[model samples]
Target: MSSRQRGNFNYKLAFKLFSSFFFLSAIMDVLAEANGIFALNLLKTLGKDNSKNVFFSPMSMSCALAMVYMGAKGNTAAQMAQVLSFNKSGGGGDIHQGFQSLLTEVNKTGTQYLLRMANRLFGEKSCDFLSSFRDSCQKFYQAEMEELDFISAVEKSRKHINTWVAEKTEGKIAELLSPGSVDPLTRLVLVNAVYFKGNWNEQFDKENTEERLFKVSKNEEKPVQMMFKQSTFKKTYIGEIFTQILVLPYVGKELNMIIMLPDETTDLRTVEKELTYEKFVEWTRLDMMDEEEVEVSLPRFKLEESYDMESVLCSLGMTDAFELGKADFSGMSQTDLSLSKVVHKSFVEVNEEGTEAAAATAAIMMMRCARFFPRFCADHPFLFFIQHSKTNGILFCGRFSSP
Candidate 1:
């Protein structure tokens, strides 16, 4: 081959490889952002009373549903793909591959922090899942297929799955399936669990921790153990009148907590309304913040929340998956089976040292920014997210309203 031709060939090869990587990365981002929107919408639905605290893992729920989507056919697949933000750019196959790539990237060991994500498929012994579907799930989602006697021993099967979840999440999450959550009619269950433990890149001073008043509402105030720290971190100003954002990294830069504190006078509802997946991306961009000295006062709080997500997901346009006759999961099994229920539970604790979190989701059948000089005192109702910085995957998101 001529030298000019060889050079052109090399250039084309490099471009193709780069584009491939970029394409997969982009799809991961889309899935992550779509999960964010789903989280917000669900939170809105769950918090219609607007007084209760909200917390859960969007990533855990998404991972479990994505596994189900792999077996979904026709409109069932399309609705899920849309709700989960699975783009059709590379079609279905590439979408699953992208999830695999992103999962591998996030779960790769060797960091100062610990993050473990796992999935499992628990099916009744009588049901025969497609070989191709089983292989794809194991290959892409790292989920192992297990047979449980859900038909004869529903409670035993539920306990077994919940125990597995607790083990995977380091016991932070327990009792993912409540009594009667899994019944004799249940044939298949999919579960995903994620656990994270990390020390702060800059730890808050234990000596500086003290009781501070937290404004839960216009009329209610309660004392909370507020942790304090002073460090140079990324900061930005965002949303309504005077909302501020701060990014706090854990020991490993791979994962970080993004906090959005609205002004004392402004209600958190304002912040919630303005939060969208696209806006979240825009606010978290590295370019949005310049390193500056920030005095942070955050409450040391633990939140645990559980939700039966059947109706929540249906409201989000994923109706067909849960319907017995309407659902199409032919790709999974020749015998007709549809999703029965979805349950999710999450736990998060933040203290002077850092943060530890865990979440679990089981499907029985169906599926920020501030200014430079500003001090961030999370003493009022505020929004926060613990996210994987690389893939922009939100592990846990919440609004802290009360002590």
Candidate 2:
């Protein structure tokens, strides 16, 4: 070829590569924001009563639903897509590919931390799933297709799946499929498990920890094991909203915990109501935070939470997928099978060493901070989430009100 032609070819190749990178990066942002929104919405549902502590892994739940969406057809697909923000993408193919890339990205562990995520599909041995569906799951989600005798051995099948989940999560989660959660009528199940353990880049001294008062409400207070540390960190304080954010990085810069606390006089509900995908992005950006040396006091606590997600998803406009006759998952199987229930369980422990957490969610389906040397004391109710910095993937999110 001519020299000019070769030069033009090189330029075109470089441009295509650049464009692909740009596109993927944009999609990652969209997925991150969507995950954040889902997290907040789920919390809203679980906390509507506002009398209990709430916790779960939004990423795990989203991954499980995304797999379910793979088989969804017609209106069933439409509703799931809309609720999941997958409709913002070009199409189902792109969304699945984005999730595929994401699952791979976030699961890659750095030298300083362990982050593991796995997806699986469990179906009755008698059921026949489409080869295309199984292939897509294996390709996009790296999900294994396992056959169980849910028909003749309901209890055994439930125990087997629960054991698999526990093993995947290092035994941090167990009995995900409660007794009576599975029955002879159960035909298919989709599940995802995520486990993460990361150490603080700068560890808090054990000697500084002490029992401190944690204000649960206007009139209630409880003593908590509050961990104290003073260091230079990245932090953001919003005067208008009366919220403070702190970013605490793990040993590697790949992951970090972001904490959001309302002002002393402000209730957490005020900040929660204003949390949106746009606002989450705006708050986490580097430009929003200032570097300073400040004192930090955080509670050392462990929590476990479980939920029957069937009603929750239905209320979120995912009704068709859970309804027997209305459900259309033709792409997944040729049989007359629809989601009966979805269950989620998660456990989290945060201490001076860092954080260890695991979460499991079944589509029985139908399916931080901050830097500051500025005295950021988390002695009251506050919201916190662990995220992958590169992909902005929210691993786990929760609120600590009392202890």
Per-candidate local distance difference test: 0.79, 0.81
1-403 in candidate 1: lDDT tens per residue?
A: 9999999999999999999878887777667766677777766777666678888778778778888998899999888887777754434687678778877887787887766665787878788888998899889887877888988888889999999999988887788888988899997776666666677876776778999999888888999999987667898887443688889888768888988888988878877777777777888787868787777899998888878888888887999998888889999988787887777777777887743330011111112144454588999988888888878788877888888
On TM-score, the leading prediction is 2
Best by lDDT: 2
Give residue 154's lDDT in candidate 1 (0 to 100).
Answer: 88
The runs of at least 3 residues in candidate 2 whose Cα sits more than 4 Å from the true structure, single-residue gaps closed, are 1-9, 354-373
- The 10-residue segment of model 2 with minimum total lDDT is 358-367
Measured on C-alpha atoms, candidate 2 has an lDDT of: 0.81
Instruction: List the candidates' TM-scores in order.
Output: 0.89, 0.91
RMSD in angstroms between candidate 2 and the native structure over all alpha carbons: 7.6
lDDT of candidate 2 at residue 82, scale 0 to 100: 76
